[model samples]
Target: MAIRDQSYQRYDGPVRTGRSWPVIGWSEFRAYWRFWRTKLTIFAVWLLPLMYALLVLVEAALMEPGQLGADGPGHSHLNLFVSTQLFALALVYIARGCGIVSDDLRHGTLQLYFSKPIDRIDYMAGKFYTLVLLGVVSVFAPAVLLAGLRTAFFVQSDMLAEIVVLHLQTLVLLAIAIALLAAVVLGLSSLTRRTGWAVLGWIAILIVPLIVHAVGAVAADISPWDRLLSLHGLVGLAGDALMGGADAMPEWMPRIVPFAAIGALIGAGFAALNWRLSHLEKIT
Candidate 1:
């Protein structure tokens, strides 16, 4: 009886096998790279970041030693580096993210992806890696090259440690900023398939908070902590951190505020992305 039951269970119904995890991983990785290549072909991803990197090199080459001040505004390669990194982050986010989801939908590819065996989490994980990879390559890569050149050319033993620490700090901050920006832009783009509408959405997502802060900075005189819940607020906080590290801003708070805001923004953006993916399933 036991032998008969075992055989019966084996033949009870047809079994469906899912795609192997390794294959899925590879496929998703390849898909991400494909998207990246397509995006990179555009000028902003390739040309703009390169130009920005060269700009950093130029400015660093121009910097004279012992000119940076402890309390006053002056030229510093470190300041230029941070500022350039921030600008690069903004450039990549606005350029790449504007079309990440919109183009897929506009091209009618998103529906096919929805029909795949992959879950929303897996898809999102892939998207997250893709965005993070681009950020690393575009922002951190240039910063590293410039820092190396500067350290080799000018920095002393004492300044070397500071330069290393500053590079690490900038890397962490840039990663979080770019990742959060990607998620928000991708989520909004997914919600609406039109590229024009997506670009409009991106602007609205970024601009509204600045308008609020401008009001608050003028009237309320409160900590801009409330602003972090929005895009501009979060970037503004990160800017403070970058500027603080470069001695461009007054010293009062820890650099942790920007890190914390990045964490929260990324968390919220992922949650929203998950919601969008779930909705995609319903429609498909």
Candidate 2:
């Protein structure tokens, strides 16, 4: 029988400081972007904005000077663009986020992640940022760029102020939508070990409420506040409000309801994710 010394020896290698979440985020971002399918989806989403920009340019060249006012044609176009971007956000969230956490769990990598230098929050943040990056690229960035292009080339001088205000509103709305949706998807991802189940959960959470809301809207008289049960309806209402549309919501419905609903959703998502990870950590 032989026993060898197992004394600790500190290596002279350079130590990295600061939170590693950003590094984790960047690494995940690059890895996802490397996939051909992801790249194709992003390109396809961007093409929608590009096509709309071309239409705007053609309309600007052919139309009369006063045909498009600040809040008339321009506002309509902006709303359409925002709606398209939101749709793209949903697709990207489902495609890219479905596997983020579930893959780690299914592959038995959760223990490996927990053994690293980062905490659960950092791990979650890292995975969440990947979806955020996709949203910014596929939805937010294109919308802002198209709006700036339209403002610069087509919008009139007198209407620039109004257009700028609308643009700012669009920016804020898009940011809120992206953050809330990312939180919801990531939370769902953390709950399941199978990617397909996570994807199905996301679809159920997003779609089931819409069906209920629609049936309620049709079969029974429901208050505007009742629409908060539908996540899609709440976001649509918020978007309408941002665009100053008349159909935003009934005056009886408080303006804060949409914000509150989205906030609650995001809170529940993160709470579920944290609880799952904490229990997993204890068991591992």
Candidate 3:
């Protein structure tokens, strides 16, 4: 026979205090992985990077020193690598990251979140870091692979040091790109309650100059080939400047311009995110 023992017990648990945004960030990150769409998208994004790695392998195996356009730093493969970063990440952001803030607003969850042990900074940081992680997966991971492959393949030559320098240069470039893209999307996500609208807004901002060029709002001189004002072009320009390849950059688009423009865009992103969060705080 089982006897029921009834007694009053004091509740005891570790008090959750201090900055707790990581709690929010970590939970959100886990939830994102649970979605099948995220799994499929991640799988698809890796294919291009692996395919590009084939070129590196082929050059090392068969081609002459300069046969496969191997003149620039790391044979200009890193430059080509940068061009592949944006498109796949854009799909992931649209599928899920674009909803980072809008979903909370749509579901009326901010009040509930505020009821817990976190504030807006924590919320923003968590959300910001989530997108940055996605950027790492979509951009930096593949880059490191290529960097290592190049380093290993060219270990016997003077190009080893140059390869290391190029990798370091790209580290800076990738950081700027990952952070800027995350901020821009997160900031835009805060502006509306519909993820679809947020996605459209992000896409528009990223390619605004192209839309302008198409409608003649931009000068004819700023046609497709000469445009450097867009986000994608600015990133490429910054890479060129950092990697000592800015000689080909146009006179109008000075090297300093991309640095200044990237800074301004990053600032603008956080400002927009903060503004929306402040509005939510007032209401909550």
Candidate 4:
């Protein structure tokens, strides 16, 4: 029989009953931060954003006010900066998110989590919060800050409000994009216990669709709308449209198609997460 430690006393501490997810989120966030890969990816990704900052400074100082307007390339720079971070985003997702759920399951940590007052929803919320926070810091912050910097240095007072509104709209769009990606990453992470396989699964999810779309476009001469299967393509089209850049979609395809594709992807991700949760309930 296992010996019991009689020296341990029952807790008389205050039973605080507030949201527990933030604690779980911060804990997971710290764990990810300790990884060398996470640190390196963050350091490397910030360099491009710094260059974009310098470009913004020069353009704001020298370019004509009209060039920074609604139809200007400045907005594209903002979108482009975020797009360039997608590689870094993927790296970070692999570093931290790929194992977020699987590691817990593999090591039997969920039992510990469930032993506490935290429900499955709170635990899932923490996981979502961690990935979303990563996305915001790594992708959303740079893009939005550049937008703000442009608005501050370049815009005339009369057009200030309009620019703010446009940039805010773009920011919200980017945020939605971040959340969608987070959901997909977490959902995929739950499917396997091995981090390596999770990473491969994530890669396949992003790449296989494009390969299929490419084959169809070439062999069947499919319409441009078929790109809805390509995650990268859908995001690119959505970003350009959200940035109010020139429309990237075909005239035949509705503007809503990319957004709808994003919604569908998010729904699929949630389905995966719920399926995993159901599995956990069955076993535990």
Candidate with best TM-score: 2
Q: What is the lDDT of residue 126 in candidate 2?
A: 83
> Count of backbone clashes for each model?
0, 0, 0, 0
lDDT for each candidate structure: 0.60, 0.77, 0.77, 0.76
Off by over 4 Å in 2: 1-13, 68-77, 154-156, 245-247
Error of 2 at 164 (Å): 1.2
Give lDDT tens digits, candidate 1, residues 1-284.
Answer: 67756644346677566533344435544554566544563335445446655765776567665542223332244445454555555566565556555666667765777677766666666666665665666666766665565555435434566556665655565555667776676577667667678778777766676687778788978574665557555555666566455354335546677667677767776776677666664545
The collision pairs in model 4 are none
TM-score to native of every candidate shown: 0.65, 0.86, 0.86, 0.85
- For candidate 4, report its TM-score: 0.85
Model 2: number of backbone collisions: 0
TM-score (C-alpha, index-matched) for candidate 1: 0.65
Poorest 10 consecutive residues by lDDT, candidate 1: 68-77
List runs of model 4 lying over 4 Å from the truth: 1-9, 64-77, 212-222, 240-249, 281-284
lDDT (Cα, tens digit) per residue for candidate 4, span 51-134: 888987886677675566545334565455555766567767876688888888788888788899987778888988988888
Give lDDT tens digits, candidate 2, residues 117-203. Answer: 888778878877887888888888988887788778644557777777888888888888888888888888888889999999988
Rank order (by TM-score, best first): 2, 3, 4, 1
